[model samples]
Target chain A: MKKRLFTPGPTPVPEEVMLRMAAPIIHHRNPEFMEILARVHENLRYLFQTTQPVVALSCSGTGGMEAAVSSLFGEGDKVITVNAGKFGERWTELVQLYTGSSTEETLPWGSAITPERLKQLLKEHPDAKGICLTHSETSTGTASDIKTLSAVIREHSEALVLVDGITAIGAHEFHFDDWGIDICITGSQKGLMMPPGLALVAISERAQERINEPARKPSNYYLSLKKALESHAGDDTPFTPAVSLVIGLDEALTMIRSEGIEHVWKRHESLAAACRAGCIALGMKIFSSSPSFAVTPVWLPEGADWTEFNDALKHDNGITVAAGQDAFKGKIFRISHLGYYDELDMLTVIGAIERAMKAIGLPLTPGTGVTAVQKAFLGK
Target chain B: MKKRLFTPGPTPVPEEVMLRMAAPIIHHRNPEFMEILARVHENLRYLFQTTQPVVALSCSGTGGMEAAVSSLFGEGDKVITVNAGKFGERWTELVQLYTGSSTEETLPWGSAITPERLKQLLKEHPDAKGICLTHSETSTGTASDIKTLSAVIREHSEALVLVDGITAIGAHEFHFDDWGIDICITGSQKGLMMPPGLALVAISERAQERINEPARKPSNYYLSLKKALESHAGDDTPFTPAVSLVIGLDEALTMIRSEGIEHVWKRHESLAAACRAGCIALGMKIFSSSPSFAVTPVWLPEGADWTEFNDALKHDNGITVAAGQDAFKGKIFRISHLGYYDELDMLTVIGAIERAMKAIGLPLTPGTGVTAVQKAFLGK
Candidate 1:
């Protein structure tokens, strides 16, 4: 049963990328692997929209987040994180682990962070060392305005602006250089459409120096940015890397390049819009007020059974959609539109939801949802 | 061009195993993955010759080593490491990072520690919390007498006995239960015939209790044994694991299990004996006084051009052997007989070396090495 993955991460791997991963394992120190590493670095920099040297570490997105917190701050340094969703809370947790003091501007699950609030928080904590936020909050299906947030940070403080672009990188319009993101961290599993292993961290010269400062204690050996950059320059890792996954990533990056970054971002935006439009046509309300292009958080009808809807989608229709996390669980379901998705995949998913809703006597419009998505995709 | 990898690790990955790796990735949270992880654990126990839980981590063998050091010992606890080879020296380094206090038993490269000397060291440092050593060190191809060393440690103190069995676990006989090893660590690339990214660690209940103690300073989080075990119980990782490599490892373990453990060890021993006999017939001195079954370290004949020998083996015969590390660079070469290899593979690698030596105008014996290897393997 080859069911397609509509999840935000561990996305459907392209056949070409999967075959590339299956290639014979080469020594990391070998020249052939070195060439691949060099290309991957160049491609990552291009995709991140930064001229900065992006240090590649063999860990996950959370590891990169941990590295940012551990490397940049000391025990008493003040930091602020925008807590819009789960990933935002993760930033606060990591910051607390490294720097004993931190603050959070808590937004409701479906709500986005307003730039006015960000500026106010920065003013409140003028001594803060840095600010952290997620580009796409997968748990809430919302995206914070990085361009607006970074501009606010630039105006108020010289603190580093760290962005967790784990779920948004290839799917959203992010310019690390133009957006003034000091530390941009992402994972391979998300929009990169590769199995998780490599965590990509693009660090500016400022962040690098901040990492080397005497006050900042050594974060970790494996996740050490200093160690990763030293070995990355020579096209090797300080530790044994996930070799096969690196190969898959090289191929995935090539595909992204071939498709063109702007076109890929446009595809994601359009896909998400179509899914939303389909839901609206079915007389369903979106769980997220400010939805991102990565995923669509949908609310079940009043007193409707989420377990039944999810079971019908997965077991009967062979479609797997994620339920909400934390407090949102059982109240809502998420449909992802990120990575290796097309109009037909979205239509099939929407069709399943329509049929399942009608079966449960939820009073959905007949074929209206599927046709709306198809027409939206076709620009009709 | 085809190449035979004679490096101690990443020894040859069999074609079937590579194909197994090419299989599509499965969701780690799914039942399919649970079955795979469960079977992998069972097979790992078989490999380690222990009934204890053998945990699989999504990092290199070094990660497992770090996990053992960080989770078991505290900031001020004293540990003893036998520095007999490069890997043994690594234990000393890791101990410094985790425990902050360590005593070393330094032995020369290509040398093994005597059980009596270890006992003497333990007597001097009876309060030490742990004793760590490499069962087989790949850098110099020296195999330690782990059974005897464990006995000596047991006699002196209640300290845990840890073994770095990275190169020894499958190729060399390691009775984790019988030898009373509290912790044994191995990697997938060597002896297991899989790529890097998976590390195996079998822990005794005593070691588990030490790790579970909350008072132990958290030296590291990603490599923490407690965190890993907590996640493993639910068929998930604390982080996104190296998915494809785990799939490859499952296949490799299946192959190893199909060939009984005792038979696998004997095959390695026999192949190693043949390699040693062939090297002697070629008039080369063995580097290690007590060589390991995993790799044979051979000192080049006096006045032999090291550059010419290494280059010719690679360029002319497409055989890639490992050069000696550190001070032994250009002084010795290592031929590995571990992982997805047999008599034919050994013949090919040794034959290449013989031809390369003759090409360099250093040896007089033609077909002498091959004949000896064949005779030993035939045992007639």
Candidate 2:
């Protein structure tokens, strides 16, 4: 069976990007690889919507977060982390692990961190060295208002605003420089439409200044941002990077550039809307009050077993959707509308979900969800 | 013009492997990905010739080397590093950076560290916590006698024998368990016939025990061997891995398994022999006294400019080979018959080199090298 992937990350890779990565492996120190790296560096800056050089690391998204935490700040530094979902919790954990002094602004899952709340926190902790945020929280399908939060931080305090835009950058609208973001981190697996391996971080000049401060001490050796920036000037990495993945990312970024970032974001928005309409037509509730265009979190109909529901989608229908994590497990399922997805993919997943729901004895008319998706696509 | 790659690392990837990697990306946490991981785990064990679990990492081979150094030993622990070439020098640097107490057994370039030399080192510094060796020095085209060195280390001291088999593992004969090697590291780009993103390390039970000791303090976060082992038991990585490269590696390993490990080694042996025969017929000197079956480093003929020689091959003949590093730069060139290469590739490269030599005004019979390679293939 040709299984379809609808997960938020490790999304379906484009054929062109995959074939580009597979062509041949080139030595990192060679002229050919440097050419590729130069193109990748430019495209990453374009995708990040920043003028700063983006440093690529050969690890997961968490590695990028760690690099930001371990390199940019010092021990006993007070960083404020906004915790709304799993990734936000990761920021809290990293800040605690590296700095040992962090104030977490906890919020309910599926809720966005309001600018007012951030302003209050900044007023409460004027000594905070940095502010950590998850731009698009994959766990709860919620996208925070980073631009507004950044403004509030700028007005309220002098702390740097760091963001995890792993699922946001290419799918949603991001204005890094204009929004005053200091450090923005992302992964290759999400909006880039590539496999999981490479993590990219764009650092503002302010963050670079912080890193270059003579008084700052870094805890990491391999993931030093200072070293990465030094090597990036020559279109290289401090450590041996994931060469093939970077090639794939170059292709992905080229595709995104050609498609126009605004159109890509609109496509995701339409797809998410269609998915939400389809779920509603099937009598399922949207799990998040504020949903992201990257993925739609849908509550299973009351009393529906998520295991049987997901198994039916996979085993019987050749479709795979992500089950909820942590506290939401067995209560919700997530359908991704991010990278390499189109209107047809949305229709297919909706049809499969309708069938799965019916098979699991939920009250749903055949073709109802599909009809809703079609209507949504038609802008009705 | 389509270029032919002949570098030692980042060798040509098989078309089948490339196509496999080009397949739609799958989520890392999926059951299907777990199945692929299980198969890869088994194949890696078979390739490493060990009963131990081989951990897969998402960085270059140097990352694997760093992981071994940062995890296995602590500060002020003395270690002995055998330095014969660029890669060996890397071990010395890593030991100095991590342990700060390394005695470098510096041998002349293109030479192997003999068991007797190692015995002398061990006798002089019996408190050495580890012995680092490069099985195949890619820069010098030399393969050290790891089996003999391992036996000597076993008889002499309690130090762990860690090997950098990046260029030797799949191309040469490596017996992890039989040779009593504690840790053997290799990259995906060389013998695996895949792109350069993944690194594999086989750890002996003794090494695992050392890593798992309660008193062991690892300096790394992302490349933690203890975390890797715990995750490997569940067919997972502590961090998200390079999924597409692993998929490509699975195909490459399947091809290796079908050819049989012994046959793969013999093929490399024959290919290397043919390359050396061709170079000799062209009046070129083989650089290493004890050459590896992975790459053949050839010294440029006296008074011949290597830039003109290599440029003619690349620009005119569309062939790319590696030039030597550091002191040997512009003095020697390397041709690899390591992975996804056959007798036909050897013949083609020899023919091109002959043309390149003639074009660069070096003394060479037109078809002498090609005839020599053909004769070697025929076992004449």
Candidate 3:
């Protein structure tokens, strides 16, 4: 069977990137690798739209999130977390771990946190050390208005704004400097179009000042932003980096650079639009109110079994999409338009989904979704 | 030029493993990946010589070391660290970060920690929370007697024995269960013959008890062993795993299983002996007093510039080895016999070193090191 990946992350890696990784591994300490790392940092800054050099760690995006939390705030510090989905809940969980006090400004899953609510939360927690939110919530396929939230933070609070841009950075509109984000964290498997391993963290000057504070002691060696940033300044990694992943990312980032980040975002937007149109045309409701360009979610049709539907989509049609996570499981399914994807890929996915839905005895015509996809793509 | 990677950690990966990783990316949440993770965990136990399922983290070996430290002990805890080389120094740094106080048992670079010294340290620090040491100090290519040291610790005090087996696990003899080790950590790039990304941590029942202590609130989130161990029990990962690396590691571990881990250690030992013989035949002194089977450190010939020597070896001969780290930089160069290495590979490396030496105008028989490598391998 020709297996296809449609998950938000671990997306289809460009063959070039995979081949780059497949080559012999390079030593982190090697000057050759140092040049590659330097290039990757520069390109990552462009992707994050920042002037500061990004700190790349040899861990997943969750590690990057923890690094931001553990490094920026001290124990018992007051923080605010936006909990709209699983990823947001993670931010809340991590914030609670370090900070003894945290205000979880949460909404129902698949719902967006509004600027007014964020402003209210900021006003409520006057002593907030930081505000952690997801730029694009991967679990619920929800995208938040980060620019507006950042503006509100600037207006109402002295809290540092940390954004989990894991699924958003290159896929959505992100301006680190313009929006005044203290830190933006991302992973390789999503917008970077590479396999999972490396976590790139872009930090603003404000974040660096906090990191350099005399009293700041990140309770970690590997995830220490102080150590990572210092080494990155010297174009070196603090520890043994995931060299193959880094090398592949260099090529992947080059692809992003070649397409331009704006184009990457535009492509994601187009794919998401087409995917959502197809879902609606098939009479399925969209899951998230604020649909993310990275991924789209749709509620299952009435009487549709998730296992049978998924088996047809995955086993029969060779397409693998994600099911709803946690409490929402078995109710909704997701399709990613994140990385290394195009209009054709979305059409293929929707076409496959249509077949799966039909196989599961859902009231659907074969060409209905596919024609909707073409119409949406052509309209865009 | 055909590039050769010989640094200790990011060693050469097997072609099969690289090919597996080069395949289309698989979602970490996929059942296929779960099966791969289970297989990896089981085989990691075989590699570590233990019955426990190893906790795999999406970070470097240093991350694994820190995870063990931050998870097992707490704030103001008194921990003991062995500082022999760079990696050992990392252990000291990490311990000092979490533990208010730490006793560093110091040894010169290229020297091993004696079992008697460990016993004495254990006696002195009878109130120590835990003791952290490197099974093989990667910087100076020195291997310690972990079995004897564990026995000493077993007889002495109640400190947990945590070993950084990054360079030593598959290359050197290890017995996680029989040696009474509490926690042993290794990475994929070492003797597992894969790229850098995954950190495999094998924990004993004794260590789990400490981790599960009701009062234990590890000052970490991403590096938390409690979550990792819990997830591993369900054949899952705590966070997004480095799926390609894990998939590649699954194949790499399968290779080790085919040959047997004992034979893996023996092969590394044989390669190290041949490398050491080649160094001696070239009339150069071996650097480490307790040279590891993973890597062999050799003192540069008198009046030879390190840069010129490395340039000739790396650029001219296309064989990339490592230079001495930290204070020993420029004083010596190191050759790795770590992973995916065999007799012919050793001969190729030694032959390149000989040619490189000749290019640098060293007085030597052309085939001296090569002949020695061949003789050593045949003798073994």
Best by TM-score: 3
C-alpha lDDT values of all predictions = 0.84, 0.89, 0.89
lDDT of 3 by residue, B1-380 (tens): 89988888788888899899898888888888999988988888888888987989999888998889888987788888989888898889888887866788888999988887887788788998788889888899999999999999888888899998999988899999999999999988888888888889999999999999998876788999999999999999988899899999989989999999878889989999999999899999999999999999999976688999999998998888889988999998899988898889999999998898899998889888998998996763
- Tell me the RMSD of model 1 versus the true structure: 2.0
Instruction: Tell me the spans in candidate 2 whose CA falls farther than 4 Å from its real position.
Output: A22-32, A74-76, A100-103, A214-221, A238-241
Indicate the DockQ of the complex predicted as candidate 1.
0.54
TM-score of chain A of each: 0.97, 0.98, 0.98
lDDT per residue as tens, model 2, A1-380: 87899999888988888778876666777788889899999988988888998999888888789889888876689999999999999898888877766799888989998888788888889999999999899999999888888999988899999999999988788988999999999999999888988989999999999999998755666667888899999999876677788888889999999998889889998999999999898888998888999999989877789888988899999898888989999988899988999999999999999888888888877989999999998866
- Residue-level lDDT tens digits of model 1 in A146-170: 8988998998998899999999898
In candidate 1, what fraction of native interface contacts survive? 0.39
DockQ of each: 0.54, 0.55, 0.83
Which parts of model 1 are misplaced by more than 4 Å?
Answer: A214-217, A301-303, A358-361
Per-model TM against the reference: 0.96, 0.94, 0.97
- Clash number for model 1? 0
- For all candidates, the clash counts are 0, 0, 0
Across B1-380, the per-residue lDDT of candidate 2 in tens digits comes to: 87889998788888899889888878888888899999999999999999899999887788788788888987798989999998998898788877866889899999998788889999999899999999999999999989999999999999999999999988899999999999999999889988888889999998999999999865666777888999999999887788888888889999999999999999999999999999999899999999999999999876689889888999999898999888999998899989889999999999999999889888877999999999999867
Deviation (Å) of B168 in candidate 3: 0.6
Q: Is candidate 1 or candidate 3 better by TM-score?
A: 3
